[model samples]
Structures are given as C-alpha cells and as structure tokens.
Target: MFSEERRQEIYTIIREQKKVKVAQLAEKFSVTLETIRSDLKYLEGEGLIKRCHGGAILGKQEIKKISKFSDSFDISCLLHDLLIVRERKDRKPEGKVCVLGSFVVDIIANVDSFPKVGELINSKSNSIGPGGKGTNQAMAASFSDAKVHLITKVGEDHFSKYAYKYLQESGIDSFTIFQTEIEPTGSSISYLADKTQNNITATYLGANNTFSEQEIDISLPYVSEADVLLLQGEINIEANIKAAMFAKSVNKIIVLNVAPYSEDLKQLYATLDFITLNANQASHWADIEINDINDATQAINVISGDENKKVIIYMDELGVVYFDGRATFHIPPMPSLRVDTMAATDAFNGAFASKIAAGGTMHESVLFASAFLSAFIEQKGVTAMPVLSQVQARLKSRLEDIRPQIICNEKRCI
Candidate 1:
C-alpha cells in the first residue's frame, strides 16, 4: 500500500540531500518506520534504491539525456508532430555493433515450483536459447539492422558452435569469438515460475573469463572501425575499461549496459556516451534511494551528472527514464504483452544506437528504441527483433492510431 507520490517525494528529498534517516522520513511524512520500510522494500525491488544500516543514499545512476536534435527538430513546438515523423526513412543508420563482453547459452525451464533440495521438479517446456548480456546486446543490434561484431569467448564445444553459427546465420560478425579449451562454454540455468518470477545462474566464468587485455588490444582496431561499441559488465573489468578508452580515443560512441553490479566499475561511468540499467543497479552503483519511479531521474542525474552525458534508466513495465543534458523524458512503456523480460534492454540499446548512428537525434533514437522494444517484448526472446521497415511500420501504425485524437486547431495543422 505504498503510494508512488509519497515514495517519490521522500526519495527526491533523500537524493537531493544524499541521506535521509527513518526518523526524518517518518517525521516528514507522518508515517511509522515500518511503513517507510515497506516503501524501501518496494523501491529496492525495482532496483532503484538500497536499504543501508540506517539511512539511504542516492542510487548509482546519473541519468542524463543529451539533446541530439538539430534546430529544426529541437523546438518544443514540434514535439507532438515529431512523434509522427520519427518513422520517416531519414533516420535509419547502418554500421555494425562491436559488442564486448560475455556470451553464454541460456537454458530456461518453466516449472511450477522448486523441488526439495534432494529432488527434482519437471518442467512443462524447456529451451536452449542464445543469451548472455554481450550476445543479447549483439543480437539486439543485429535485429535493428546493424551489422554486429561480437568480441567474446566460449569453450570449443558444441554450444560454441551453435552460438557461432546462429550469430553467423543472423549476420553477426564472429571474428572476435575466440575459443578456449580449458572448460565448457558458459551457460545460464534459469527456472521460470508461473508468476514470471525466476531464478537464474551463471557458471563460474567458463571460457568467457579467458579474454585478456592482449585480446582486447587485438580487437581495438575493430572498435575503431565501428560507429559504436556496446559493452556489458560481465567481461573482465580491466579489459572493458581498456576497450572503452580505446574507442573513446578514436571518437567512437561508447554505450555501456552495466549489469551484475561489479564493484570494479568505478571508472566506467565517466567514459560512457550512455549507461542503461535497471533500477537496483542504479541504486547500488550510484548510492541513491529510488523509492518511486519518478525518483529515478534524481538517481540518474547523480550518476552521469547534469552535464552532457546520457543515462537511460530502463524500469521494465514502468518504461524508461532518459536524462540528457537539456531535459529528462519519462516515457511510459508502450502497452504490449511481455513474454520474457530478458534481452529487452539490449534491444533498446541496439535500436537507440542505430538511430544515433543514422544521424537521428537522441530524442528520435529513444523513441525508435522504445517502439522497437515494445514489439520485441510482445514476442519472445531475441528472435523478436524486427527489421527497420517493420519497426517503422509499427511506429506508423501506432502514430496513426493517435493522430485522429489530436485536433490540429487549424493554426498548427500544417
């Protein structure tokens, strides 16, 4: 029974001041400590805040949005019209995604409940799917019609072959898919329940941990050639920083998706073009309390700053919070049925990058990504990503549906 309005107000206060005690919050809101705890629990669940020993801190995300529009498109007078024209053919970018991070085969089981520790519960259906933050991000970029160059390691095993061939067939580059024989390829074990809550696992490193700085040096050339480099935290932290610096040196846009909450990501923030994350990762890394959805903006601004950096906070069904230098956009989720929550952010980043690469502004890119992701979530897995034309079609259809409701008032009709 936590009110979003109350949660957001308290969260905003804490974020502004950097700390808020239970007494302060309760005194300000006239609520008991127990009620405040419930609010904290809800915020914690959304990945927006952390409950410290006593008070709370701003989440790790500095959500900043950048203004990428030209003078013609930057005017607030044109925003409504802008949404309609976003699907125009002028905004498609084609290059390739140089993905840097881990790759693994995801094994998902749909089950009713966990068996006793010593026993087993059978599943209604199971799947051997392509995933891992890096791979998923690569697939997401590919689905946006960008050529993808994946830099990862997998065991020289059957799963590696399957993953490689799938990437190849789907048109992702495999030049950097190095192999190792020391252990099996990494795989994630997941158990999905009827409520959509699930348990997941990652095997200890496996071949993915084998990637070294030397290997990153070898791939620096590719990073230079690509328009953008997408990175995930699952890789060795040092290697990731090295690659980010290299890409930045060449003026390549670096987009980071920091997951798994590695303590080693201290320097990753200052070097990114955009950092997308769930609420908790933002809270954990940025030291913010995200008690409500709107409070996400405060967390985001803390991580990236009120400067030119762009930080996208993907809050799942709550939609996305984008902070650019000029403004903040709280775009609600496009109504759609979500089959699986995995890989959606990757799809968002891929499409967003494609829009930027194609010379669209940040606003345009986010809108495209939002709509594209809506489509992906409606289907299941990475295979749901559509080609550029299909994405446009969906946008067109959605916009057309809303156009009639917007009366032009004669003066602005044209």
Candidate 2:
C-alpha cells in the first residue's frame, strides 16, 4: 500500500480507539517498530495525535471554563456567551452562505518580471495548490466561521482529491460539489511578478464549464436556506444565471463578484443585492472608463441606476469604494507587507459575505473584509487566508489606521 494510504488508516485507528500503543500498531500493520514510531510522529505533527512514552492519544483541545461572573452579565453579553458555548458544543457553523463558483488547481511560477513575447525566462520559484475564485472565496468564508456550501464542478481525477481534502480540513460542506467524468479539473497557470506583486494568469475552464441543469436543481434546496448566495463568473453563465434566479425567487441576498468579466451577467445586475468588482470589471459593466476613485464613483452611479443595488469597487492600494445608492464611501487599505496578490479579491468577498451573514451592518462588514484582505495579502499560497480571530485582532489593532474616508453623504459613514 502507498504510504499516504497507510498513514490515513493508522490515523483512523488512533481516532476510533482514542489511544494506541506503538507496538500494537507495528504488530497490526506487520511493520517494524521504527516504521510505527515514524507514523506516530507524522500523525502527531498533523495534530491528529499526542505522542506519549509508549503510545499516542487523540489530539483535542481542552474546553475553557466560563467565568462565574457571567451570572451578572447583561442580557446581550449573556446571549453572546451562550452562542459561543453552543458553537463549541456542536462544532457547527452559525452563518449560512452558499458560494456558487469554480475550483481550479493553481500552478504559480514566481518571476522577477514578465517575459517579452517569444522570450523565455527561468522562474525564481514554483508551487501548486488549491485556487479558483469560488473555492478560495468559500474557504475564506469558512475560515471566518460561516457555514459555507461550495457548489462547483471538478473532474474525477487526482486533482479532485485536493479539493475534497481541503474542504474537509476547512470544515466547509462539499456535498453539493459536482464531479465531471468527461472533462479534466479546471486549472490556471499564474506568473507572479516578484517586484510589483502583480500576476498574469491563463485558465482552462474544464469541468467548471460542465455544471449542468441537473446540478442546479440539486443545489436549490441548499441555496434557499442560505442568508447569502455568492456568484462569480468562473462557472458557466447558464449556471450562474440559474443560481441567481433561484436565490432571488427565495428572497436570498445575492452578491455577485464579477471576475473574468462577462457581458451576459449585465442582465442580472438589477436583481443583485450587492455587486463587487475590480476597476476593469466595473469599467466593462458600466461602459465607462474607470481609472481612479473619481472615475469609479461616476461609473458606479451609472451602473446602479437609482436602484438599491450596493456597488463595491476594489481599488488595489487605494482601498475600496462602496456605494449604497445614497452614499459613496472610500475605505483606505490596511497596512501589510506585500506578498502574493492572487487571492486578495477572493478574501475580500468571502470575508465580506461572512460578516454580513453573521448579522454585521454593511459598513462593518466592509471594514472586517478590508482587514481580512490586508492580512491575507501578507502571506503566500492557498493558506494565506486567516481565521476569524486573526481578522478581528487585525481590525482591533489597526482600527485607527484603516478608517474609511467618506466621499459623500457624511451622515452614513461607518
């Protein structure tokens, strides 16, 4: 058997038995004592077991004791404490969000700069990991304590297991994730410019484009229960439209993040509760030239069309511009060391949706998301996204530094 398969089995045994001796594992597997010891060490490193002198036990964190002073706490404080307790007891998430998108394995090569056409250059480093806007956003939402359901299609291949393992580890529900036998898993090759932190990418849609009408039917019930349904342009336009229409019929809040720009999605703009995009996407959707905050404000006004649609334009280093029909606020970017810029927008969208689902006001949610993206961009690879605690801490620490600049309608500044 393969080492990974053997290690997985051993992990299961230790989990079911609660504890197991090294000698017993060695005897059961017909392996040498040294091999069993190595397995135990590996499991321990993965935080699946706690090694003792002769055996290993399941690794579980001890629950903290609530303070006796809670009896005198206010009703709101008491309720907050109770919710925390409930989350700890059930190990289930509270905020409900459905992310309808794609999951592509990203192959990234870091280079000092882009090569000219017909030229070749050696990369500084290369890595492969979980990517695709949909998966990244779903995982980001999961990290922020949202009960995320990711509905995406992947091929039935080796790359598919990475998606399964990642979702399992992140505690996001993947039951709605579909698999295609005919097409290979979607993938992207990104060249990261080391000096400028910019990335150029090319993608193959693959199974992402294979989401069928049947899969859409299967996802309706789950999507109906969601507080928010997040859609991106990575998947087929038909699937995105179908999901949006279903969510609208059920009165679920629809948040559309327009990436890879699709002209067909323009028809659904009126139905969207919130629309998030970068400058290029906004320019395309609004049919105007957008280069700065002033240009973005004008473009958003044109696209919003006096409706209640909220528009968020992510302005890279200049921060984000938020228009809630009445007011346009400019939120400054949080301070962070520059790293990979691959997942910044996904982090923002996921964190924003997570905060909104958790009952935060629009302004508060944006602030929280900004903090999350700041922290996320400081790290590299798929693990760049931070947990809720980290985001909250960053928000608290940088509260004064990253305050939003109210451009107009000063009455509603958050």
Candidate 3:
C-alpha cells in the first residue's frame, strides 16, 4: 500500500506535468513500474487520474496537491478512504471498528459461602482482570483481525492507564480513547460458589457514567469514519441514543447490543442496522412473551416492523435468529462447552460486525459470528477469541468431522 504521503507525492508530479509516464513515476519513486501501475490504478479508482498509453493524466476532476500538515482533515479522510481502498486495492487494514461502552476491572474470586452478619467465608483466591463490554468487544474484533478503536471513558488513574496500555498492545488504536478525571474506573466483583452456579457482580460505573454529549460529539468523526460502530448500553441512555443518531446521520452502520436491557430500548431499536440480544434481553426489549426460538422469532417480527430494521435474537444453544426485511434465518450454535457466558454476546457482535466490514454478506456474517461465539464460550476469559482464520478452519473441520455422522443419519433414513 502506498503511504498517503507517497500518494500525495505522485499527485504532485501528475499535477505539475499534466501527464507522466509509468517508467518516469517508477524512476522518481525508485520503485518498479508494476508498483507505480498499482498506485496509478488506486488513484484512478479514486477518480484522481486517467491512465493513457504507457502514461497517466489527471482525471476530469482534478485535485490540487495539498500539503500533508495543512490538509490534516482532508489527509485523514484520504487516509481513511485509502484504508478502505487498500483493503479492496490489495490487502488492507482489516476494517475500522468503534466500540462504545463499559471499561471495567473485573475482580474474580472463589469464596466458600456468603458472609452472614458476623460470620466469614474463607476466600480461596482473587485476581484483577480488565473486563468491560466495550473493551471485550473491541478485543474480539481485534482478534478477528479488524482495526478496532475503543471509545470509552475511564478514570484518570492507574486503571485507566492500564486499560489504555492493554488495548494498545492488542492492536486497538489508542487515538480514539477518551480519558477523564477520576471518579474511579468501572469494576465488577464476582465470587464463585462451589463448581456450579456462582454469586457475582456489583459494578462501579465510575467515569463510564460521565460520558457526555460533548465527548460523543468529539468522537463523531471516528464514528463517521468507521465502517461500523458498535454500541453497548453501559453508558447513559441519552448518550446511547445520540451516538446511534450520529452514526445514522453519517450513514455508518450501527450495531446496537441491548444487553442488560433498559427501558428506552424501543427508541433505540428503530435506529440500528442490527440489534443483538440474548433470549432474555430480547424478550424484555421486545416486551413480549418469548419462551423458545419460534416465539422469539414472532416477537422480533412484531417489533421489527415493516422489515426495515434487522434483528438478531441470540438463543444460546439454539443459535442466532436473523430477520431483515422478508428474509429470516437461524445459524445454529456449534457443539462446544459453555464455560463462561460473559463476553459471548460481545464476541458475537464484534465478529459479526467485523465480518460485515470485511465484505461478508448478512448470512456469512451471522454464521461467522455464531461460530466464533461457540468457540469463545468454550474458553474461559477475554483472551479466548479465535482469529478469523481459526474460526473459518474450525468451521471447515467441524463440517468434515460431522460428514460421517451425516452419512450415518442419511443411511438410517434410506
């Protein structure tokens, strides 16, 4: 991929000469004609240049060579466009993702029993981990090889710095993060009981609750620049609504996950490109009685009126049901152990949105998301997300592994 600087350089030469030969560009850039040809093709697609016989000329819509520093906004726009073109141009940045929601420090512990008045329960162990809906989803998108940016607020303390550092190392771009003065960072305290069900969670909103309209306005450029913007309901209801509206204003696809359901979800649903929620959350958001997949489908159908908005009802083991317009389908969950249900929905949306940005259709996106979540749930924590290749490989292998079983079942029918 040609650097935006280099692309600007080529544009400069083309502007000065009005016409330039491929060999000359190759010489000036100290590269091969093939490389110059590739660059010219990119510029041409951008409506920047016209390739002539053995040479190229400025296109009908001429662009002045703008300075890198002077045209910062324009340059940023070009860089973003170039990023998209580069993905299509050759191999490019995997897509840009914006994750808006909770950034929490998860404190996991194993305890004997609930402490009675003066009685104490022995604490087996404790570990501090970064776990938040926004960060987790951003991580999943990154693991799937997308260029993700997390738009979250955290305290101006050690936890915030640590969160920023963690995200930076994981390939999430740090430029899009928002840091505010303390009001402590958000957190969750979980305690496991025996080896079965657990008693967990008292979360601190901290700076997460302070996400203001001003901050959201400032973050709009990133949102608008992104191919997809994922919204989590961890922030203020007004903020979520504004962010969804902002995304819609810019024509960026919005994927809203109404987890931890809220009273204002109906207002939110009409703005989303896709809405993902577990059976419980879906049932609650749609305000209908949903006991099974069929009921869930009917509920979604009623709420998603005119088929204008798409809905993805996540039915745990039964899989995910998708309805957009007249089309309705379900992608069944893969057979895998469910160790931790936390972040599973985030994994689904992250992978699903990433796939869509990577040029996958609705069906492909949902299936890929379902496959990723199945593998994700089988693992324990945040780092459990599989790569795009790994998910695809697992999907392929699973199919092959089941071929024999399919044949046996078919034989029984025969």
Candidate 4:
C-alpha cells in the first residue's frame, strides 16, 4: 500500500484506540519497524498524534476532570465549562462564502394601484431600509452559519452606515466593501400594491456602477478562498464578468442570480455552475413566454443545451423548476402566510448559496432554500430573515410530513 494510505490507517487506529504500540502497527501492516516509526513521527509532526515511550496517542489536548462539588459550588467552574464548550465549537471547521453584488437603500411605499400618467395619489405607508441584491443575499448566507465575505461598493455617505452596521452585526466580512468619494450610494424606489402584493421598482445605479474590473481584481484573494462564489446583476456587468472568470480560474463553484434581467448575462451562463432566475427573467433569457412549468422546461432546455449549465426558475406560488441538463424536477413550495415578498428571491438565493458552500448537493440546497424562504416571507422585512436553525427545523417538519410518500416511492422503485 502507498505510504499515505498506510499512515491514514495508522492515524485511525491511534484515534480509535487512544494509543498504539509500534510493534503492533508494524505487524498489522506487514511493514518494517522503521516504517512504523517513520509513520508515527510524521503523524506526530502533523499534530494527529503524540509519541511517548515507543507508542503514540491521540493528539487532542487532555480535558481536565472537574472535582466533586457541593450545592454551594463556585460559579467559576460553570464558566470554565462554558468556555471549553465555546472553544470547541469555535475551533470546528466552517465553510467560506463570497458574495459579489450591490448595496442599495430601498425606499418602499405602499400604494393602492398604479397611477395614470398625469394622476396623483397618496401612499398608505412609507419606509426606508438597507437592501440591494448583494447585501440581502450576503446577510442571508451569513444567517445560514457560513463565514461570508461581501464585495460591493458604496458611497461615503450616511446611507453607507447602514451597510456597515448590518454587515458587522451579521458577522460578515466587509473588508472588500469599497467606498467611493464621487458617486452617491445606490437607491431603489418601490411601490407595492397592498391588495395584489405586486410591485414596481426603479433603481438608481449610483455607486453600483462604479465597481470596475480593477476593483474586482482586488477581491481575487477573497474569491479564491471561497468554496462558492455568488454573483448578482445589481453590480456592474463588466465587474461581474471579471468576478466569474476569476472564480472559474480558481475552480470555485459559481452560483449566479440573474435579477432585474440583464442582456449581458447571456454571455455568463457558460461560465456559471448554476443560474437562478424568476419566471420572467428566464422567459426573456430563453426567448420564450414562460406561463407555467411546461414553458419553463422548454426555456431551460433552450438555455442549457449542449452546455453543462444548470438552471433554476422560480414560478411564483406554483413552485421552482430545476433543470440540470440531464433531468428536470420541480420543488414544491412550502406554504406560509405572506407578509412581504420583496426579499423572497434574495432569501432563496442566499440560503441556496450557503448550502452549496457547506457542501450540499443541488437538490438538498434547493430544498433548504425553499424552506428558508417559506419561513422568511412570513415575517415583515429584511430584519425578519430566519436563521439556519429555524430553517432546518422547518425543513425537518416538512420532510416528516412527506416521509410516507418517500417510503412509497422507494418501495415502488425497489
């Protein structure tokens, strides 16, 4: 056997037994005593084991035993135990995610309906908050327990404070968030109809347009370190293209969310591992009118032909359709009370990207993302986004409800 494989076996033995003698390993592997000693030395150097008196033991630091305590035990012992637990949790490995997008302030107003060209109307309510496809998606990924790095541009204005504070509180690394002195921060004005829950939006690409290829190049280190990179259409198209190319160079998985329908994204499909879009955006990209799942399937086939590209089309209320070149499947939506649907797509993309970064398969990620959005839309705004635990709980409940169908399907296949 190869030395590396033998060493791995030796490490496993040491871990399982907590200690192992050199003679025993040499005899078990049919190797010389010198070879066993070398393997043990290598493992010890790599911190997988510790050598002592012709034997080796597991490398993990020994935990101290707590003494017997009475009812009047000191509080410091409890604190020490809590500290140890926290340290162990913190030292565990975690996945890294990089998000490239825009950070815009959303000025939302509730209106009765669309006004005529020369008509005037009064809004029921108005509120402003931090938004933008990039910021929202980054926040979503962070809430899903991934270490997220958000790359975007904002102006050195008052609006930028919201981005800073939000990212800091969300535990997202914003070191790549460039600040422009000339351009103002991006802003979006939306009018939401109270009855139908449909809305129209207008965005001012202020600082969002300022991110150039140079800025994208500066973020190459973060992109290279990420297991998965997420891009959206809110930033400059050239910068997005550069980001995609850089990620591809480093063999990082790329998940692109084509929002607001950009014609430039047609050239990017071949470079992306997965492309997510709403029904209208997919219809436009595929040059077909997608009225339902059948139309979406046709569109997916048109867009993903010949290339190994995957596509996800969000069909409102119906569900989401996924096409992975070889097969097509529909993920049913989880039912929930709809309060605000503005951030639904962002929530889905973020959770999906998080799952991908955490090494989940495409189907698993989509299921988790669907459950996350179901829990997200039940709340009011961006502040109401659900965490990873809440989403997992909801997904568990959903799976339990569908267990019977799963069992039946398995039996039929068998």
Candidate 5:
C-alpha cells in the first residue's frame, strides 16, 4: 500500500478501535514496525493522532499528559508509561519494588586481552563507579519509573560517597543506604577484554559482608511497602534468607537472580516466585549441560524442583528461555552491535523485577527485560543503561522479532 493510503487506513482503524497497537498495524499492512512507526509519527506530527507506549491513541488527552509530565524527568518515557497505564489500568502493579542486596565501587579497566603470567598490559581505558547486583538492579528499576528502595550496607568512606553519587546520577531518587565504620565499602577490579568484549571481575565485598539479620530486620519496613522483593547472591546468606522469609510471610512477589550462584540458597528456591540465572549457573545448580531448548527446559525443571517455580535461563547466543511453571518460552536475542556485556544480566534482572512487580505476565516481563538489555549491551558500564523511551522504542520491534520465536505448549522451546 502507498504511504498515504496506509496512513488513512491507520487513522480509520485508530478512530474505530480508539487505540491501535503498532504490531497489529504493521502486520495488517504487511510492513515493518519501523514503517508503521513512521506513519504514526507523520500522523502525530499532523496533530491527528497521539503516540503512546507501543501504540497510537485517537485523542488529545495524551498530549495534555505529555505537557504535564514534561516539566520533570524524561517526558518521553514517563508520558509513554502514563499513556499505556491509562490504556490498561488493570495491569498497573503496585509500582514499587524493594531490593535486598549489596553495594560495590568498581575499578574497571579495558585491555587488549587477559594479562599473561608475570606480564603487564597497557590499559586502554579505566573508570570507577558504583555497581553491584543490588545497585545495578535498583537503578534499572528506577529507570522503569518503579519506586525502588535499595537496602544495602556501605562503608564510611569516599567510595561510599561515589556510591550515593552514582545512584543519584543514575536517576535513583530513593535509597535506604546504611553506613558501617568497621569496613570500607565493597570494591572490585574488572578487566574488559577488548578483542572479544568479555569481562572478568574480582571483588571484595567489604562492608556488604557486615549486613546482619538485625540489618535485615531494620529494612523490613521498606520491604513491607513493596509489591516485589528482588534478591541476588552478592550479599550474605543469612540476610538473603531472612529477607526472603519475611517477604514470603508478607505474601509479596519474590524474585531471585542466582548470579555467582551458591548452593546455600537452595533452601529458598521452592518459595520464590521467579528465578533468573544464566545457562552456566543453571547447569551448575541443576547438574545438566544446556545445549538446546529441551536441555534448557529440563535444567529449569530440575532447578525449580517443582512446577510452581518460574525459571529463566540466559543463553549466550540463543537468547533467553523461560519456564512459566509448566511450559517454556524461548525468546530470540535482540540483534545489536554489542560492545560490552558486563552489566546485561544486572539490567535484565532489575527491569524484570520491576515488570513482574507491575503485574506483567512471565513472557511480558521477559520481553520487556530483554528489550532493556538489548539496548544495554550496545554501551559500556551499568550507568549507560537506556531510559524507558529507548526501551519502549524497541518494544514493537521486539514483539515482531519474538513472536516467531515463542514456541509454546508441551515443551516446544529454543
């Protein structure tokens, strides 16, 4: 169809349906999502339609919302979220997530390759910033406009100063940071191997080790207010157990990212609402080598140990495979010129937790988190994670890419 004819049809459809999804329009026209987006862009420019999160609306109210929210924050992202929420009010979760985790200051350097025994390599670039499973996840949740309270311990030192600075600059407006005088804040040295874009990090979790059960008790007030509790393996085991038990008692949605996996956490596996880990971690825990979708599905079931646990495994080139208790869904990896992947998992977990907390079904949150991660791998550092608008811009394209890859029903995955 010609551009003018397609736009007319899209206008008519919007008038009829009130709101039209980009994917549906692209499918109906037998065109690319970007093409439909362009048509919508032209129509929106003509003041005939308003573009929402993943679709277009047929009213001026979206424009009013844009003007109201534009004065603060990134207007495009917040406006997009508002329009979507208004369009689907029932899906809006509590909009709050509480993360129980750790904080770390990273000293990262870029080099040609791993240094040989007793050899020194010239560093290409280096940076110091705040990072940790907990810190990165909290920032990612905040990026999605989820109110996040990161409960972690830091040392009374200059690095602690950087911790607060990094979170503030990264758009985290809330914190439950605690300081310890006994040990300095956690620190790590990461080497980014430039040739392959791989990374190796060695960390000393300083004050984070000092977080006790008492500290977990102190954080209960914040945890009680959240719809989701996001946990990671970076902190002490006792703290994680205590936090998990409390969140379970409160009947909150509990999610765990088993990075740097620990066998000690097996105790909490049966009770978790969602579990995210890479293929290697799943393999180690489930005692299975993940080769394909079938292998991944088996690994998920073994690790989950029961049908009630939802599991997600991140495969390097094959993308993500998720088991929603009974069935498995495999989503193809988003194509990108990946420069650094160090923070991809962190960003994914954070975005995933926020989405799941917002009442997003398993596949919906997986797609959303993967969209956030696709934009994330193109850059370096956790701080370089994309805003909601960038992620939203990719959502339609992602749906297009993911539809063919989603193999449902009795274990058709890969």
Candidate 6:
C-alpha cells in the first residue's frame, strides 16, 4: 500500500485502540519495523498521534479549562464549562447555523489607475450587487448545504426591497431581518484599481450598525436553534456580544470571522470555538507583523495566548495557515485565476462553519473550505457561489482529492 494509505490505517488503529505498539502495526500491515516506525513518525508529526517508546497513543484534544475563580454568576462561561462535558448535537457536521452579521449593497467601480486625491477619474466598469461579509458568509453556508438563519438589519428603502428579494430566493433557510426606517440600507463604495485588481471599500454603517439589545433578544430563538453561531466584526459589537453570550449559554459552537479589525474584539472573540481571519486582520489583532509563515506563526501564537485555540490565518492568493495551539499546518492555496477577490474570506468562513457543523475534523473542514474557496473565487460575485457539482469538480481537479458529497436541504453542499 502507498505510504499515505498505510499512515491513515495506522492512524485509525491508534484512534480506535487509543494506543498501538510498533511491532503490532508492522505485523498487521505486513510491513517492516522501519516502515511502521516511519508511519508512526509521520502520524505523530501530523499531530494525530503521540509517539512513545515502543508504541503510540491517540492525541487528545486539549480543551482550554475555564478558571475556577471565574464567577458562577457569569452564567455563560459557567455553562460553557458544563457544555464541554456533554455530547454535542451536531456530531454529523451537517447542523444548522445562525449568522449574526451585516448585509450591504456593494457598488464596485473599476479604474485604470488610482486617481490622485480629489482628482476626478473615469471608471472602466461598474457593477452593483449583493455583497457584505455576513451576507456572503450566510450564502456560502447555504451553498455548502447548511441550513442557515441570518439575523441582520437593513434600512426601509429601495435597497431594503432588494435585500428582501435577494434573501427570499437566496436559499438561506431563514432570516430574521429587521427594516429600520431611520437609517438608509447599508451600502459601500469599492474602488478596484485596474492594474493590481486591488480594492478599497468604504462602508456606511447605516442600519447594519444599529442592532440593539431588544433586537438581539428578539433573535434569541434563532441563536438558540442553531447548532453553530457565526459572527463577524462588521456588525454592532455590543449586540453581537450579547448574541454570543446567549449562544454560549445554550452550548452552541461559536465561530468568529474577524475582519475590519476592531480593538474591542481582539481579546473576547479570540476565545471562541474557531477564530478565522486574514493576514491583515491577524497583524492588527496580534499586533505583530506577518509577512511569511514564520511571522504568521508568531502572530498566531500571540493571539492563541498559550491556549489550545483553533486559529486560522489566511493570506490572499497565498494560502491558509491553521494553528491548533499545539502545532500549525500550512494549507496551500487552491489554484485559480483570480476574478473578484471580494468574498473569498466570507466564502472560506462560511464553508468552514458548515463543515465544522457537519462534525468534520478541523483539518478536514479546512480542506473542504479550501476547495470551496477555489470554486467561489473563480466567479465574480458572492451570488456566484458554485453548486455541489462545481465544488466537487474543483475538489477533484484543483484540490486533487474527493470526499463524500456534503448534502443538506435536499439540494445544497460543500
């Protein structure tokens, strides 16, 4: 058998038995002792198993322990401590998700070159469509075959009408969208330089940033109903924090996609079940310069803060780095001709949440998200989320691997 297959078999054995001797593996696989040792070494190196003198043991996931001094009155953290002791409902990884985030209409303008300050310039092309980190992420999860319920706000205007129309047909299982008459619908101006394809977006908070405790309380049912709650930095921090605290109370998995780097989220959001962010956000969060893997590692370690945190860092068009407290793995970029890079982060975040909800291991979820990303980016807009076949094809051709098709809601997947 190939080495990869052999290693996988050995890994299974160690996982089932919790320990295995080198000699036993060699005899079982009809391989030499050296081969068995090599397999054990590789598995240990991959953090799947722990090598010992004459055998290996399955690696244990070291969950960070909540301090005893933590107040019992702090019900959320107290409940979370209890949560780790019980069996979670979403073991199949195909569970429901609730996204407490924002949706904005994106106005993208392309230019030959960035104009000088205050100098008027003409655009080569322009387009308007549905785009927002939250909207994109929820769509990705829906496309990944997860049943998603999005909780957000929009203005009571023409844009709001489009928002309602879009979500009504967007395949997201449900949405608790609030229409505020005071503020205009959330919107952004994106300038894309022709040469570099680089972009700068300025967003008007509008109704997106007006979430209140009352609204969050109203959305509590969706928060409690979902197996996983996905959050981002784009929404109102106070409201999202309350939503998160509620999710924690009910033992839901919390995943934060930190973007637009906010100082308030640095300490609190990092403690979530999964925290995924791009390199720029990581640099700001960890207060470290991240130019390469080593630099990224330092930033991850700093953000991890000596806990067994599941932290992932993405460098656009470069690759994804996942640090699981103990070790870090570098997942290579999914090769694709970059089109609109606007929603890549949201795509990955949403896909990752779906896979995690489906009970895939962190590595497997990363692989799945990586494949989804390659498929998502080849297209131009967030609404251009590829179907299962397209993602499966990307998994076959681009990622060079295939797994069971993720199916949910009778017609969606990752």
Residue pairs in clash, model 5? none
Cα lDDT listed for each candidate: 0.68, 0.79, 0.70, 0.76, 0.78, 0.75
Instruction: Tell me the lDDT of model 2 at 80.
Output: 30
RMSD of each: 23.7, 12.4, 13.5, 15.4, 17.7, 23.6
Higher-ranked by lDDT: 2 or 6: 2
Instruction: Give per-model TM-scores.
Output: 0.69, 0.76, 0.69, 0.73, 0.75, 0.72
Q: Show model 3 residue runs off by greater than 4 Å.
A: 1-92, 110-124, 192-200, 399-414
What residue pairs are clashing in model 3?
A: none
Error of 2 at 57 (Å): 35
Worst 10 residues of 1 by lDDT: 77-86
Clashing pairs in model 2, backbone N/Cα/C closer than 3 A: none
For residues 215-321, could you state the per-residue lDDT of candidate 1 as single tens digits?
Answer: 68867878887888888877778888999998888888888887867767757766788887778888887688776665777776676664457777877767777
* Candidate 5 global CA lDDT score: 0.78
lDDT of 4 by residue, 1-414 (tens): 324435656766775799999999888866789989998887666555789888899877422221221122222223331111112133232567899888899999988887789999999999998889998998788777667778878887888766655554554543356667778889999988877777788999689878866667767888998999999998888898888998998899999998979898777876799999999999898899988877877787776656748878888787788865457777767878888888789999998998889898888888888888989988888757786778888999886432211211111111
Order of candidate numbers by lDDT, starting with the best:
2, 5, 4, 6, 3, 1
**How far is 123's C-alpha from truth in model 2 (Å)?**
0.5
Error of 4 at 358 (Å): 0.8
Q: Per-residue CA lDDT of candidate 5, range 240-291, in tens?
A: 8888999889999999999778898787875589988998889988999988
Residues 106-217 of candidate 6: C-alpha lDDT, one tens digit per residue: 9989887788999999999999998788888998987887878888788878898688667756777667677666788899999888677678889887898888787788
Question: What value does the lDDT take at residue 401 in candidate 2?
Answer: 85
lDDT of 2 by residue, 37-153 (tens): 898887666555789989888778311211332222212222231111113233356678999998899999999999999999999999998889998898788777887878877
Q: Using TM-score as the measure, name the better of candidate 1 and candidate 5.
A: 5
